[model samples]
Target chain A: MAIEKHDKENSGGGRPVAEKGEHIVARHLIEDDNIKEEKNLVIDGVDVSGRWNTFIISRVNSEFDRSFFEEIKKTVAGSRINRCWQCGMCTASCTVTPLYRRFNPRAFIYMMQLGNLKELKKYIDVAWRCVGCYKCSQRCPKQVNPAEMMEALALVIKKYFPEEVKTKLKLDEEVKKIYEDMIIGHGRLDLAKLHTYAIQKSGRTKELLGKIERDAIFKMVKDGRAFSVLRLGKPHNWSSSKEAMENYLRKLNTIENTEAGV
Target chain B: MAIEISNRLGLANVKSDYIHTAGRKLEDIHERLLELEAKGEVKVIHIKEENKPIEAETLLGWKKKIPTNKLWHHKSCGQCGNIPGYPVSLLWFMNQMGLEYVDERNQTSCTAWNYHGSGTSNPVGLAAVAVRNWHRAYELGLFPLFHCATTFGDYKEMRNLLVENKELRDEVRRIMHKIGRELVIPEYIVHYSEWVHVMRFEIAKLKKYDLSSIIATVHPACHTYKMIPEDCIYDKDIYAGKRTAVSTGVMLALGAQVADYSTWYDCCGFGFRHILTEREASRSFVMDRKIRPMVREAHSDVCITQDTGCTTTLDKNQWIGKAMGYTEQVPVMADVMFAALACGADVFKIVQLQWHTTDWRPLCEKIGIDWKKSEEEYNAYLEELKAGGKTVNLYEYPKS
Candidate 1:
């Protein structure tokens, strides 16, 4: 019987021996892609197939680039990056957090502080939804001014995650172009024109005047509210200011394009 | 439960420690501006008229002098473009009270909606625009009263930046010089709602409609108070001085049931850019955060706010809610417009409630306003206009 047991052990078979993958503790926790294996393999004249070659790509981050922090600190909105103590006050008071559980200002600031661009990359979609209410800034005990920091986050994302932003977010180019033209052309926003543009862009031009909207427009026209622009006209002395604004805008575009390597 | 208690206590301790270490209360921009004024570092346009003074407290128990007269109306583009009645209603109130103001044509829209919404303009551009507007007000010799909360907040931030950063001051000053204007910051950046708040009693005296049965919920515009929180007016009489007293103060003074709800601090979901780009988010946010709670929790008859965007969002987004089968919705309007309406201003001509998309007729009828009669009168007025008749003027300036 001892000889027979020895023979079984030498043959790589024993009474109730463990299977290849049974040795892996908490197998459910390891993702399928992460668990490396091969159906057949040889290394140094040895087969290391199946669970023998299993390995996990380490989820632990190994790099911290503090230069990103420095880049953010230079911005007017993010000048106070050093004041946050990770108290979660900003997140608690965040208007976006209630709507999007992922849009946590506290976490964003902490990640910014730690220069965790890898982790910050995950939040590109929801990061722009801050709404700029400043409730977080109001309630922040540290006075970190997380509202402005969120703006800083926007700049950083635009700079660092351009590809992701391009794919994930859609710029209302037509509306934005109209806004630019109006702000440059008249020195103020024409909501009437913008509303028309919005309706047209949304393909709701057919429904431009819903039953209620039609009545409202009729009332407005009758009351002369529809032609208010004709009455109020443009801001006084807007031409010179518009020239200066255009000059500044041109200079700004150049600087931004240069920074973006455009 | 024990963990939560410990965590809360720990947080409190940390906060107390932070405050102790900081060793000072947050500086009020007004105080800092006064110090700068003493040193001739900046120019401040003071409230120098025969103005009615109201005692309102800021967040840190600081007193704010809210001027109720001699105002320069800084009109909102959105208010002027979409809801013309917003400014007209406020102007009508000024006319009724015999207050002095300038509805100046030179006043620009502040362009903050563009800045906040599109992120097109930088801080320097914004600050330059702000100082230019302030200079215009100074040129007129009147106190600048913001008609829009977004402008008010944006100006507050611009003021902070100008006060702290000399380089920015130089840049803005250069831009101002380019426009042939000087750097002028207002002594007190007042909102029209704060004006309504201070004059609530006088408005109550002029109140023609009984709002006793009207249960109103106030959506404090986040831009009005949340931005530059230290400057906003809070009264102990209203919400124990915890909440802003602008809209709620007016409602309470006019004898309305000012109901409280869970999401009072949430944004109206105008969301600036979100309103333009992500319309669904804005619409859904207003519905879930504001409309639903006002309906379910507060049982409100109306949602009164103090900003143009808040009014528009709260009023217009109800259709989105209705499409989503949210059958309950409350009428939304500016506090001053509601006050004007309560003071028996012409609904179609002055308050111009007809411009609103929602069915505010039900709300008007609830407050004893005859919608049918008002419509008939409006139609008749239109006919008269068509027949080359002169329209009603809120203010009559004496010919020089």
Candidate 2:
């Protein structure tokens, strides 16, 4: 009422669009994504009308996420979840936290500790943002190891919503297939092929022809990097380790299958 | 426990006889190096922080030491696999300094990579491998110096676990025994960088090329400095702190302006297998937290790291920034390579400049390294490649 009165009193044939939230004073503070503004709105005999019919969603988290905490704590990486004491040291020391506002290690720990799954649900997209820098673990006063905790978060989120994670993550199967085959075939990362393949995949083919890159390629050829690659060659007699890894994978699959069954 | 058995034999216990002291933390503690040395089990050198720039001969204990003798070299898979120059650079500097060392091919990979990457490889197998490698080193009477920071970090953690925890110790011992190698703890566990830091002054004196113009930044491998902070050699730049103690000291000694970037302490986002399973996360880590800060904030020319994983991560990920239209590049190289470069090691033969993912040519320009000479030599290798001839390696050297 006050905004409408003020806009009418001040408007000397001025535009109404400039008066964005004529109904609300703190309109500029709310994000467009969260704010619901309907023009020419009328609901159930109520004059909800226009952009003034704005609804600012509450940002405050109301619930805790303990089940998610337990889920994380059970994982080998997050076994130390009990050690966090809500000190913001992990967040302060986090490498990712500065780059991203939502990647708060301390808040995540507190939310997980208190079972604030509702709040955590909102962060599912950014949950995998942690790069596993381990700085949080090194500097954490409580040794919470938020680095691996992020890994646990990634796993639990994957487990919680498998289909969502698969679609959201969208692993480049072709890239992974090439990567795995090289590792399995050579028992090493195969830097030359890996380098070329990664550059090619990123669509930076033209960059390869640059003077700096050409020189680096020449240097590698002259230097021992190329010789070592040639010298190390492929894995000899890799059957035993291959069999062992296969067995381990099979056993792991079975366990995961049984757990999912529950 | 040894004293209780000695009491029955009327054996004279030397431990209680003397109160020897060396200035260190827990100063004047009983059974110091004097008493410990008498036991013949281990030797301890009580070093103090105030005693800066101490002689290499004065250092003692396996936690951190300066070994000026023949040492067995355990090459890291990542070092050999990712940055080819890393091991050779360290070896070249050691040779330049006339410090004797040995490398072996029969030694199996530590398998720490497999364990940390996928969690499938067992610690028992790794512990046995460590002990077996130690036994081989012991046979040659040389201490094992690991090139891989993770290996050093992992072995240290494992050694502590194997010694303190009786169950794991017995398990590892059984595995080692089955393999016909007895479990004997190494006399000293030290990363290769520690030797570089200890010998920084000597390296500075012998510097043929000044690196003061080159803006080099250091990333202390998380494993070396943080994993087991107590066992890690240096704490701070001068004396102490867990952040990263050694790399900066060597960088400064080489006369390079050490750039203190915001994320100097941040991991390169290569958490063992973390990169393999989570490339986006790893890339985000290196670029967002590490690379962006270094390039945008610090304007670093070249980044130096002590660990192989870090070198690979930073050097390789710069291409990501390049691809994304952020053309500024930070050449990542091992600190040892920088030091070797200063000592006038053949850029191609000794430092192995070719293997790095990032073109260090630009950084080389700033550091008084002639790009043209290196280019000419590289063309020679291209000639070999063009002729389809066998490249010289482990065969051309003093030994494979």
Candidate 3:
């Protein structure tokens, strides 16, 4: 079968007019992620195959949607979104930005304020990398608290982009369980148990019982310092405090569940 | 707005200038408390009874009264768990100075690690927990001095939040009532480093070794100073009052050459959650961003910090770099641990340097201590302990 070629119009005799998707000049310039092509397509009972039915999403963001801005403003972490004036001070003082340039607080705040969900979605991986170091919040010119603003961004990302978060970021359930049990169960963290469990869960059991750790344990045992951890008992009157905390947490869960219409 | 302010004040267009111009209301918390106390809105647990007071200057030039005695030690879980020497060294220093302090066993972990690392807590719940702990200290008739930077910072934030938000105070009070405790907020939430900063002169008097040959670099814990910038201590003598004075002041007082690095503002990369889940990022960050710079740029002998997480991350993560064939390494320890070492405290029994992954022998040798003899003495002491000898404890509670 012979392929049919579309006739080129003599508009200016310089370059072909990019009317359809196939005539896109300098196609290499477009990012591979943005281009969507189907092998075969049929619309209105007409067959459109290969490059004839290609679709290219525009890279330039055209709309300034404020819906996400309203959504974030309701959060305590993002309440100060209105104070930011696009000053790069927060980004400049950021500890994580120097390492991972994609995790920019100033840029993230601007995206949330303008409701640029499309652009925000692309940074779901690096967005939650803020170390909660208040260097940015300490030096923010407008007192915007870019540190807490990062928290707001994390909440938004988790809510809107659940599938992306599930795939990209590994939420270590074992580590979370250990921390929760320590905090709620005993009201104190057992470092010995945490270190052991974390190392085992990370599949680095060799490091747990390695030469360095073994020597440390031997020294601790010899000095009787290892027993000190056992002697330091629980908080005084912790059971009642535990009960109150658990009750409060249960109440909060119910309130949150009702608000979510669960 | 910032430009207009800069133009009006004839100041350079810098973020610091803007930060100064846009004044924070609760910067002078004591002053705000005076007003709030007058209205009967909040009650402050005053530091009373037998205590020594030393005045330290905060960032805003506000004089903060740091009590030197009759202190209630709030131990850090990480310090107890990972770096046993941190608290032990501080206790040894206190014993040497004959400072009266109580090592309480009833205090709870601040749980800010879980809260910040994971969004598992709300502010109200956190405020309640902090208030409960402060109330415990009040019950003991002593002012609480935090051993963890995270707890110190978290309590300071909780204080501000409880004072500013009436509903938060009510909620916390309700929680407190449920626990059969009263809502008591400390007049000042003090970190142990601040106590060390104020006692540096006294510490110098008891110094047994020459630290003049040693060059030290400081990694100020972000939670200590940066979290509540206004409340942290700063001195004109230390870095012209530009940086926090807790870590550097002690080193300078002990006569060590305090060196500066460019990445002094960078975090130790514990990043709470980053340390747990994305550990490679945390390890790489600590190695590349912090340790390498202190070693190469400053030629420092040791990296001293005040926080447990900072010390642990900076100290333990260095060995991972060696596995990747990066040879540059520096010993990291708390300010009190180094100060305790200079004071001729036991290396293994008291300071517990063996728990640390990085090598501390070279640093000790540079400070004029015979490493081999100290290790032998430590081994003999361990043998004695195993042979039914009494364990050395700096302080013991009086029998009730």
| DockQ for the candidates, in order | 0.01, 0.01, 0.01
Weakest ten-residue segment in model 1 chain B by summed lDDT: B12-21
Candidate with top lDDT is: 3
Clashes of 2: 14
TM-score of each: 0.58, 0.53, 0.58
> Candidate 3 — which residues are off by over 4 angstroms?
A1-262, B1-27, B388-400
* Prediction 3 global C-alpha lDDT: 0.79
Q: Is the docking of candidate 3 incorrect, acceptable, medium or high quality?
A: incorrect
Query: RMSD of each candidate?
Result: 33.4, 31.7, 32.1
Model 2 has a DockQ score of: 0.01
Error of 1 at A21 (Å): 43
Candidate 2 lDDT over B1-400, as tens digits, reads: 3453223112111122222222366321123333434655332322223223233221112234456456678889878777777888877766666666676786778888888888897767777788787777766666777888888888877766555555766787677768776666753466788777787888888788877566666777888877765565543233223234477778777777665555666788897765775454455467667777666666678888898889888887665443223466788888888888777776777677777767788777777778679768878877987899776662122332
* Candidate 1 residue lDDT tens string, B41-83: 7888877646666667776777788888778889997898778
- The TM-score obtained for chain B by all candidates, in the order given, is 0.91, 0.81, 0.91
